[model samples]
Target: MYGTALPTRPALHAEWIKIRSLRGTVGALTAILVATAGIQALSAAAGTVEDGSLGEDPLFAAFFGINFGQIAAIAFGASAFAAEFHNGGLRVSLTSVPNRTRFYLSKMAVVAALALAVGLAAGLASFTAGQALGGASAPGWDTPGAGRAVVGSGLYLMVMALFAAGLTAVLRSGTLVLGLLIPLILIVSFVIGGLVGGPAQYLPDRAGQMVLRSVEHGALGPWTGLGVSALWALAALAAGWLAVRHRDA
Candidate 1:
């Protein structure tokens, strides 16, 4: 006894409802906040300026939990879209909306907006908790670049989640996207950035994370690094759109 078909409402509104209805969506968002804030708070307590462990930048240290939080972000994006591909979900969605382009764009927009909202909240919470735990090394709110770093944390998370969603759309499997991305971002990127140095900075997560750093260490500046990550997301979305348009539902 479902009422009207989903397409009768504004496409964006329909997409929002569909995503919000999923239980995983709420779980993922909660994980983003808890992981980012919790881990950073713990890290801030454990690390110190004297040992040079987390580096001297309090802002950088404060945002450190993002390294873990992004895993949740990626899961949110990948699972949200990928779930549609299973059990004839995409087929049912297409039947309602008909226009693949509109459906895809609307879906992506909702995922992006949702991620950005939660990401911002997570960033703010992480920063506040981190500062409180940072003892003497923590920077004040007015510290130069502090605000940018906090905002950047949200932007970075949003782009990373979108990146995962776009990639998931292409693959049509949440598991595949999670398997591929989590390791790439968490392990491979870390190892490569450590050993290879300069070139590794171009990797999507690394590039996006530059904005969270207090100082620019790589070829790409903070904003430029984030731009690189956005470019990666855009490319993945373009590929996903093409796949959804031409392939059987």
Candidate 2:
């Protein structure tokens, strides 16, 4: 078993370097930061606590930019894998790292790491900017579930990125992944969610968004909702791994 298992550090390092050298990766990360902060700031400024609605969730407004930021995150993840399928890039990569499992794992590791870092930074900045802009109307940092919401915002972005990356790998086409996912996330999920009711909460985007709320009224709790989203990501990853293992590069 040990003989068949290759060391992964070199593969990880190579993947990391590949990601760093890509200008698109940097641009995507920058978009996550800028779009998230800017949108959250605007939302905070525009938000008002309506009379007789003291039960409103301020955390939702603070992290509203996550709605837009996740698009950039998905783009980053999709592009990372999509590049491999272009210009015979997958063949070249396989030549250097023949073990498809190891190569795929390294690629995903890089995607997850970069997404986590960018997500965390964007989440924090969005929260800070929202708080600053919202002034007294903003959610208190000490509010019961504020910390969890902030941290979960970052985790949610990371998982969503991973989910996209996995789907890209399985589909072997970033264009397909984006076409299917962007609509599912932005339109279909929301539309169907309203009409379908309970089951819609189990959808990946809806499940993940649960963490962004300071108060929970949904069928799934915060952690449980995130777990459902993780299941979606994991299912996609398993399918992608099988594709890499048996399919021709």
Candidate 3:
């Protein structure tokens, strides 16, 4: 009575449904908004460039909350894929679609779309809150690099999330990816980044964050840096696909 099943639309829809229904996903999205905007607000209330403590670029300070918000973004992406490996969920999903490639793509598409949407919202919120709290010292919306910073903040978050998602797929454990990724981003990228100059700037988090800066000091420009992060995400996703295709479900 039923026809041959199609995987594209239905798989996408199923993936969306699964993502939306997850409490962790919802919480992660909320955390992104709260962390990004809250930290920016705190920074703005602290002082401005005039104080000689915040930094020269007010726009850079305006979006500073992204440093923490990106963690929530990573969590959201990692957990989404990790859920599949739980309780034989992938087996059930495969039974329905019977196409690993389609299923994986559908899930990733849903993840990417959702992350981008939430990321943009978080960026807008952070900018508005930060600038408002920054008062006269803050850069206006029409300032030379303000628009780019805001947009780049969103794109950076999305890309970082995707990078985490791809790595989670490869590792098959959100905990593993989070454990490794959090330390890499926090310690290695932020701390060692300053000490080890040159090539360290090309690290995924460091490269992606180049867009958030008003002043460019690295070899790669804003867009080029983000492109590097995107490439990392793509490479990780490809590796994940290969693992899924060749390994037993």
Candidate 4:
């Protein structure tokens, strides 16, 4: 019976189908693409002069839309898992899979895959649109760190989604997770970072944004900053896994 049980691949396929069938999921992804590209285009048109500050970072301008688009990514990830907690969805899923670890991991895997796909598409579209609008002022493929920044934008978005997903799993309520995270990302982090100075660099959003900078001199460099954000996501996932393992489904 164990040997004949559904495998991981089939489970992932089923999760994928479930994800695609959700209108909210599709809308969130569409929002990511449209908002990212549209905002970047506007920023490019406005154009920025190369000052000595971080504002001079061309890569930053190219991917500026991420500031807004990340909200959609977070929503996508949170809703994907949080829905399981409603209407006995998680209980039904567990009845089919039986293994809590396998079921939770499969759900997370699907969330990550979908987030990465949308992130990459949004990142590339933002880059292309920003460059076209910025003309000579925009960073090109030849610019130093341009490739990394462009690619890292996608990674940043993916990790942000995963972070939301993990937190949603732990909380078992998308509203609670979003309420905490949205404010933290959009407001509290920046306010505290501004008031406190250097420590703000370690905030998940700030740390991840490090990769988007063409010129950076902070304690955490691009890759290292991303690593910090990844750690945050992993920790959240661990907490979530523990929650699901021990809690009543």
Task: Assess every candidate by TM-score.
Answer: 0.91, 0.92, 0.92, 0.91
Window of ten residues with lowest summed lDDT in model 2: 47-56
True-structure RMSD, every candidate: 4.2, 2.3, 3.3, 2.9
**lDDT, residue 132, candidate 4:** 80
List candidate 4 stretches off by more than 4 Å. Answer: 1-7, 46-54, 192-197
Across 58-92, the per-residue lDDT of candidate 2 in tens digits comes to: 67667878989999988888888888988879899
- The sequence of per-residue lDDT tens digits that candidate 1 reaches over residues 66-175 is 98899999999998898788897999988878888888888888888888988999999998886777766677587777788888888988898899999998999999
* After superposition, candidate 3 runs with Cα above 4 Å error: 1-7, 48-50, 193-197
Q: Report, for every candidate in turn, its global Cα lDDT versus the true structure.
A: 0.83, 0.82, 0.83, 0.82
Deviation in angstroms for 23 in model 4?
0.9
Q: Write the per-residue lDDT of candidate 4 for residues 66-137, one digit (tens) a residue.
A: 988888888888888887888979888888788888787888898887788878888888988877877766
How high is the lDDT of residue 99 in model 1? 84
Worst 10 residues of 3 by lDDT: 1-10
Enumerate residue pairs that collide in model 4. none
